[model samples]
Target chain A: MTRGSVVAAGTGLVLGLLALGPALAPGFTLAYDMVFVPHPVFDRETFGLAGMLPRHVPSDAVVTTLAQVAPADLVQKTILLAILVIACASAAALVPSERLTARLAGGVVYAWNPFVAERLLLGQWALLLGYAALPWVVRAAARGEPRRLVLALVPAAIGGFAAMAVSGLVVLVIGLHRPRPAGRSVGVGRSGVKRLPWSLGALLVMSLPWLVPSVARFSGVPADPAGVAAFAARADTPFGALGSLLLLGGGWNAETVPPGYGAAVTAVPWLCVVLLALVAYACRGRAAGTGGLGVAALAGLVLASLGAVMPGLLRWAIGLWPGFAVLRDGQQYVAPLAVVVAVGAGLVVDRVAGRRPELAALALLVPVALLPGLAWGAGGRLAAVRYPADWSRARAVVTAEPGDVLVLPWEAYRTYAWNGGRRVLDPLPRLLPGRVILNDAVRVGTGGRRDLRMAVEDPRARALDPLVRSGAPLTGALRARGVRYVAVDAPEEFAAWAGRLPGAERVVAGPDLVLYRIPGATRSRETPISQWPIAIAWFTTFAALVWSIRLPVGSLFALSSKEP
Target chain B: MRIAVAMLAGIVLALLTSFGVVRVITTSQQDPVVKPLYNYGTR
Candidate 1:
């Protein structure tokens, strides 16, 4: 490896260690959307054949596959650490300059920023995984090699729809505008015409794991129009939505902002850093071969800002086609903007280092300095914790019976006392052996007058909504719906609803989870959605990834490595 | 003149570092006090 490569890796390692300080301990880090169970079962849902839209399709499958080799906790920690390390190394490699300081500037800002902090805290590790792959995707697209582009997209593909969508946009924008060789014609030959289609085709093939199921089970997985307003980008900084997005800080969730991030004292300096990078990029980004990436970044920023600036248009689009609902959580599209800022920061440091080495050094430290809350596991909000033994027992009981398990309290997210009260999506859906049905509606906003309750996405969940809300006896209704087992994770909720279950048998009385069995409910067959298409997609992606594995693993990522 | 210039830069760097360190230390102590329901995150 080159000296610059080593330094870049070392920077990432240090930053990752600092950021994930407490989370790297013994157990799983159970934050919202980042639920890693001890042993994730590969059910029909793992392939997105379970009726719902399969948002977590192949990622869950990949984790389950990895768990077969290593403990899921270890796999989770490794993936999280790898996100930082790969992101840092990739961004460093993308810098146009050879100087270590310039590379460090890019590496640090790319790996350590408001976008990374907010997304990590929100527990969108899969999305961040795609973010990590984006710089490599940019590099591979520029090279116009089909195999390299496919290989670069593997991480994003594993990240599922949102990640693939973001990466696909970058690929499309960058691939369409390949730089012309000095004397070659601008729109002529194989370079200009054919390569973009190949890139798009690669993206489509990689996306098939989720895409096939989404296409197959279109009616079952509904995207709530209300989600556009609920998941819209909101201002986190004192600066309004546009400025917050410009600084990469306008995630919809206020709780996910790094500690003291929005305060003027720190935010002002961070804004200055972002603005400086933008200025630098404007002066010389195209010359540095970041052709069309600036446009991609701007487009991303505009998309992200639209949720805040123009929610009605987004809602209208989602109404027209449920697929457009992906635009709801617009902050995620800022992945490319984060890359642009990182590259721009590198340019700034590269340009000034000869005359002002101290300033260049300061630029390297500025991202970490301004966004200090990202360190030590987002101010210790994310700590490792173990699931209780009772959860396993409940899973065992439910698994032995191979039937539909319904998770209740009628809410998707939970805060278990065992999990240090950190809110997380119910793990029973993945932990249990059979089809587990849980609420998919997300309630947002502070519970004042204007609290927004999102429409339920799953048809099963939607069917249960009125039954649950009516507070009538649920045993007969649930049995009619073919629910064989009801797993209640919350204690108070179990107390309120347990009495209403007339003919049900209390199976496992939990320290953390409660499982009850409905005596004579007919078993619900798996959703008619076939797994063959998703399986084929997975196999094709796996084959392509295996086919692309020509370089030594280490050399594949090394900046100095040659294309073989 | 060069020595003076170097000393001035050193002071500025030290000052920035100190400011950052202090902010990080202070901010780290304030644990997230959001409501449990809002843990799903608020808009």
Candidate 2:
């Protein structure tokens, strides 16, 4: 069989696995959501509730008991299906031989890995799809095809944006239009950049709506120099550089990373290293133009995937490169790396299938390298650093009863309310009056050595509001505000850590979370899931799916047109 | 080449619309304090 057929079939199976895997798995949101499931944002569905109120704001949104089991958003799941379906049809219908195999190999392996799926799970679909369409983008740029590129735009906007809510940063990257000349339309020459004006102009018009806000906010908002900081401090991957790349097993302790949730030795990482190495090697062989670009594109993905966590080059990196941001708690930035790992893996698969005819069967091993990395989601069970649920013991405890204000050091509640249309109290109220915006690893305005040390070591201290001190005092404040319940998700020794306080007592204890209640507060009725962006989110999903399919199809068309 | 730039710009636009348009539409009349989360079905 020709290598082309092998690429097509192999990609088909891989994408089929990605598209079909979650459908068969037990119903669960991705691990990122699992971490954020308990926030009031997840459970309550009230419109204008979270918006109008402060972080301490209680959720007033309504809830629907039944959830749409199909899929949640426009990122991975939808994109995966869209890719498999589109690539298969395109390859079978028009793209014959090397083109079929090579592009097919590119789509499935690069686009459908577990790491990539995680980004989709976290709502980074726009970035994923935008990046997935990169090959096409570069191809179109090289060919000077306006009609096809215009056709590709509709899907780009629809699918990419549906990937998220606070999707500003990724938008910045996507908006970048590399200028190429109109004069050099069909060939490689210095004056080829003239065509750039039209493309940039069109890009500007499409981008204005988003750019306006970002530009407006850019000056006022604090520059998230976190990535820069990590690099500068030379602490980018201080936890152990190469180890994290392959670490599939544990977290703080010997917490066993659940299977397929970012384990100790996922095959994807090594493959990425090898692919990167090959690209570097290939760079020496090829000059400027497409050859340089293939290298450049791979390099961009490598940097993006490495983000801030690549380690060692932190300080030098921060000084020289302005691309990364240091994230609070730092590690959550893993999302980008996962995408890079997947994309890099895809490049490896595509390169192998396209360049080497003999290794078609060996090409299927990419997924084998990826599944083990999903172990991180299990969090080594070490991630169970929150409350333990137990109802038998009776002290004043705060549980997430309906109408109760949830104040915990986790984000689980927010996901439920945000995704499901629910309300949750803010865990951090810095300048706000609500319960919490997001808890854990949040910044404390006042800081010093002592403060830093205490913040790092004391789980109870870390969980407690500096303003309120501990659960007991926190309960007093809540009572003063007519609040009924107080949620605590600190470590098990929280009571011991706070050195024992008055007023609040534990009523319910679970391995994951705890709830507390004030004695005489009135229980206000919960507003139905009013805050839901019901029509909007669904439309987004529909739009994104439509686009993901359009992409590979358009690419196929463009490829066919290039045929002799 | 111009088309590719336009396409990149389009992807960029789509990325913006995916997030920005939603933000604009949802935030237009709402209080600045509240965050309008668009749960664009899980991708």
Model 1, runs deviating above 4 Å = A178-190, A551-556, A560-564, B1-33, B36-39
TM-score of 2: 0.49
Question: What stretches of model 2 exceed 4 Å from their correct place?
Answer: A1-23, A33-99, A112-130, A136-404, A410-437, A440-464, A468-472, A480-484, A489-514, A517-564, B1-43
* Per-model root-mean-square deviation over C-alphas: 4.1, 14.1
- Considering every candidate listed, which one attains the maximal lDDT? 1
Residue A343 alpha-carbon offset, candidate 2, angstroms: 10
| Model 2 agreement with the true structure over A221-313: per-residue lDDT tens digits | 323333232221111122343344322111211111223334334444644554563453343212112222333333333343353355445
- Per-residue lDDT for A207 in model 1? 90
Report the first chain's TM-score for all candidates.
0.95, 0.51
Model 1 CAPRI quality: incorrect
Q: Interface RMSD for candidate number 1?
A: 5.3
lDDT of 2 at A285: 18
